[model samples]
Target: MSSRSLPRLPAAPGTIETGSTLKTLLDREAIDCLAHNLARVHRTLNAKAFRREAREGIEPLAILARGQHLAKVLRRHLPARYEQAVAVLVRSLTPSLSETEGNGLAGFFYLPHVSFVATYGLDPAKNGGRDPFEASMRAQYEITRRFSAEFSIRPFLIKWPERTLARLREWTRDPDPHVRRLCSEGSRPRLPWAMRIPAFVQDPRPVLPILEALKDDSELYVRRSVANHVGDIAKDHPALAFELCERWAEGADENRKWLIRHAVRHPAKKGVKAALRLRKLAAAG
Candidate 1:
């Protein structure tokens, strides 16, 4: 099972054109469509109020900004409490993946749902109660599988590192590849396009165990997240990243070797000898 002895892993899939962008994806038409869906489940939902608010001040906002705008509108039109607001939205959502019909909550509109959680759910979930919030987040994560709660989950990791990390360790063994990916991706210290977890950037030891559990994940999606997690750590802790790369490289399978190579790529690019050495070892092997 050594690095040199391992077979090559399959290459990741090339990007496919989905004909969508942040702006267009959450555009006014999309909002109206979502309102239509919401009204189906929650009869009291003031679809007109929701739609009007979302459209009124949202002319020039970008994707994330639009999410923020809608979140505010939801707060105004939906329940007052964070938990209640989330509950209303959750109840209004199509319950299962089978019902998504290729355009429901599970498909193209998925990221908008994630944005809802980020804009409204995170702080309320945090303040509500730790165990309950965690449970709710776990449920929400099912929806997020189609999108990704990587950014939203970071605040939890920062505020409650030990509890959140413990849950993440458990998530590492989850049946879903997306949940397993979240275990690594959510805790990344330097996750791109999301806020950094300063504690993890300063000391990544807390996240190591979670990464270790996912280093050899069966899914390429999960493995890539693990690799990126390690690379994030390398930005500030090159020595530790190099050390883990070396250790993980030994007696590793193809997937684990892929993880190692990906983890070292950042430092390797920067001419860090230890990282370069690990890359060379993988190449030579």
Candidate 2:
């Protein structure tokens, strides 16, 4: 059936506007669109079977489940080796988002691709290739530019903490704010809806430097993630979060100051004295 045949797409008229459930973003049109694009980039893809598998019983799955479903189907249809499959997915991406905001649900089109990396791109030899880790990293760098691999990067961080954090340290200076943001957002100990990084939740010091590196990011988008990361830290390690924020407060610019305030907003709401003080000091700028 064509995209127009979807039961829910009618509410948004073949598009997901503000109020539509995120699940609706992965409707039949999305699967068809994804399949066609993958076929477009990799001429050898079995687009017919891929589309059929993607649609079968797909209507009942939620947003993330749909993504995983498509990724599973993609693994069957794409090249067996992980690296080649990732190369095709990277090429299939339309383009890097031009702006930081207001792109809307269009970017969610790449959710399945993100899921593809998380679900299948973790190991090298398991997926019939060498260097799948770095290959997945490169794929995420490209994918995050369009749709955010924040969720995808978590498994790598879990399985390969030292290596993933090392890569994230290097990405802290990336030109794209999205990649920069991913370094912090993907590592959040208490990232909602995403899996928890138990290590960070237990001892957040390891992720501190990432937050430090981004405390003064030029883009508010990146800085916002930085703020939220600090907030996540505060939940489990309040003193550590305060220490870093206090140090950051030394030479903080208005933007940085705003970030600190935002970071402590949750604690301040609870009347935590330390958080309240930080909020007042940074309230103006």
Candidate 3:
């Protein structure tokens, strides 16, 4: 009997409303398969925390999963929770898989854990992983645009403002495009499933440098996220956003166009103007 097929460790004390919410959002088979895999590897507790976090009202599985000696196992741990565990698992699973190095499976499994922590707002105590910042950034991308559309950076800021912002700025130059994308994506005022980052919404100036650095990034993902962040600011401060968009249009690239389109999801006359300028510039070249 795989641990995944088994029930969670002595269920949490309450009728957890979050569990119900998670059930509605996630598929039972997916959870069960993950659970079973964890159980097979003597990590049922870890799987349970992930499942609990994936939904809406379950207990903090990371807290519970920690008892399994997670801290002692891996070298690095993400602050968000369970990210460390998933990273460790990815390392373990990578060798046995094909040429892709399990990036695909890592992505698949990473999603459930991400849904659990970020969406449920449950804290998974620190554990082990390769890089904490990398874990969080990866988790942000795993979620849907809706989560991006509604994410809030408040809690992350209130709890780890300096750390979060520093990470964002630092990642803007990361070699990995996904990590770079996180630099912009994670800070969006309405990043879905994330806490609302009202402060940034009010004063997006702090993040301008980060966006400027990535406006001409080679990575499509990174540029797109930068544009979206700028677009988010536009919603709250149209004049400033328009100015930034104009600047981006100065010598934009193909990826920049995609980013502009996404950033201007809530289109405005300025967005149109920016688009025209970029198009004309491209035609001239």
Best by lDDT: 2
Alpha-carbon deviation at 98 in model 3, angstroms = 12
What lDDT does candidate 1 reach at residue 246?
87
**Model 1 deviation from the true structure expressed as Cα RMSD, one decimal place:** 9.6
Model 2 misses residue 126 by how many Å?
2.7
lDDT of 2 by residue, 147-190 (tens): 78889999998999999999999999999988999999999999
For candidate 3, the C-alpha RMSD (Å) to the true structure equals: 9.8
Candidate 3 accuracy as TM-score: 0.57
Candidate 1 has what TM-score? 0.82
* Backbone N/Cα/C clashes per model: 0, 0, 23
Candidate 3 overall Cα lDDT vs. reference?
0.51
Q: Candidate 1's error at 119, in angstroms?
A: 4.5
Q: What's the TM-score of every candidate structure?
A: 0.82, 0.92, 0.57
* Candidate 3 Cα outliers beyond 4 Å, as residue runs: 1-25, 43-112, 115-154, 269-285
The model with the greater lDDT, 1 or 2, is: 2
Per-candidate Cα RMSD to the true structure, in Å, reads 9.6, 4.3, 9.8
Of candidates 2 and 1, the better by TM-score:
2
Give the Å error, residue 251, model 3.
Answer: 3.5
| Alpha-carbon runs more than 4 Å astray in model 2 | 1-19
